[model samples]
Target: MAKNHLLLSFSFFSVLIIAQISHIFAKNTSKSPIVIQPYIIDYRNGTVTKYYNGPASFVPPPIDSQVQSKDIVIPSPSYHNLRARVFLPARPDPSRKIPVLLYFHGGAFCIGSAFGWGDSHYVAKVAAEARVIAIAVDYRLYPDFTVPAPLEDAWAALEWVAAHASRAGPGHDPWVAQYGHLGRIFAGGDSSGATIAHNLAVRVGMGHGPHLSGLFLAMPYFLGSKRVPLEPKWFPFSPNYKVWPYVCNHCKGGVNNKFINPFGRGAPSIAHLGCKKLLVYTAEVDELRGRAIWYYKRVRTSRWPGQARWIEAKGQSHIFHISKPDDPATTKLIRDLSAFVNSN
Candidate 1:
């Protein structure tokens, strides 16, 4: 009967619609070209929980019980009591001032924290094992506050570290004659953190910030786009880095300009303004390779170059070195960074 046919057609269409909806959800959930395991959920309530997708897990190495950890406040307009972590070297000699390294973390300025630095242990180990003091900053995130907020926090932290070095620890002051004058006060970070570090170097070298001794940029993302950052669905290769499901949330309903990205768009060039030594590292396979290379070239052509070095890692991706400890590439990076800090 015609009635029976109509009912059957409706049922078929309903099934089709359900299937399509399910498929779309699945695609969106795993749309990234490169899949990053060990997922995390950041809730509106300020709760952070990690979700592991693979058998591999985060097994932190043993810590030195003698090492001390403390928090120092950095001034920020966007947030009250902006803070940074100070990793004191074990067995500090009060008469000796240790070198300071201001480390910024990478999460595209949207997802990282000073406390959640997965590689904090590595740096702390270096600080303890290498006799250096590392200050890890928790800069502002996007949507809530953009561009200058992050940069401002970075500069403020550097200034605070320089001015309050003595307060953080006995003989921690970089300017004091005790610790060889804090040998080298360097700024460094991975990914977006690297981008900020590079920008700070340029700013400081140009007399915009307190004097800095060196710069270390790892896999920086220095570009901004009006269009959503996610690649076209037709692209074949997956970049291991996540594209942030809510990439547009921050840029939405706002005028696209340098305010959103000071390093992106048309910003003043700092290449010629750096006074201290600079080292830039990039992975060949990283999607951000082009931008990293561009920044490196800018450093060379800039007018205020003091000393610059660029190294391209073989068979590595963005943040890949830090994510995998057993990887030979990661080991080399740590050694090179330690050497740079020591020699510079």
Candidate 2:
């Protein structure tokens, strides 16, 4: 029965992708068929076969000298293969408990993984620099599972991490239980993952879960009914404009859904953001930079009671540091992030 739903979703998503691609190719003068193979979905088996082909997914990097990582499952009979990848400092102070960071990887809400090469490496670097025990959540992606699904998975992971705070649990992750300082926890992500992070913090603030010390949003994926000046208006050309409505069954038919657009109609107020501090980054060339800047301003002006700040990566594109880990700005971003995590 679950497989049936999965197949249906893939079918629906495929149709949408084809429609957008068709619209894109309509304007091209060349007769060559562009082979933009992001992913292949087997409707018959309800499975997705991934390769190092597109922006959707990538092979993960191995553990480095700065931090070691391990993957562990969190039992979920409702969903298959629910898990998290934990990252910890290579050299730890045995006597001191470390801060906890719950991270989500972004792929426009459709694809990406905690185990993805860039995201995993970035998390490991953050863990090492900040001296925090980080858990990169592996949530179900779209065309298999959708908006509320990813959001629910994130909540479950947070609960699982928080559960480790008590020694009575049998499913506790050893490293998290032994070393994670739940009192100084943070949640963050990039792109769609940043959307998840924002929603999670809102949920927490509304008395839904454990408290978070800070929230980090890197190039958040937010869209609204009114189009931004820089963004193209022709909806069929950009799949992102349509992703929210398609993947999010509960979005009421548009991009204004709270999950995608935090300040949209019916969305929760920024005053209830539910964190001690917030850091938002926008790339200079990113189309969504304006929206990110708008969010930063909103948070600062809101009665959220948190210190909010914005950082713009001049001359960089969206999430550029992830792909270019060796960039000087990447090091600076990591160092600044580490300072944020470490600050009292």
- Which pairs clash (backbone N, Cα, C closer than 3 Å) in model 2? none
Tens-digit lDDT track for model 1 on 1-344?
99999999999999999999999999776653332333344443444333332332233333667555666666655556776776776667988666788888887656666665366655565566556677778787643555657778888777666655344553233333344344468889998788678767767766664677888888776554432233233222222233333232454422233333334445555554454787789888777766567666766776754787888899888787556744777778877887887784
Over 110-143, each residue of candidate 2 has an lDDT whose tens digit, in order, gives: 6678887788778888888889998888888766
Off by over 4 Å in 1: 1-62, 65-67, 75-79, 165-183, 224-265
- Stretches of model 2 off by over 4 angstroms after superposition: 1-61, 77-79, 228-237
- Candidate 1 residue-wise lDDT at 301: 79
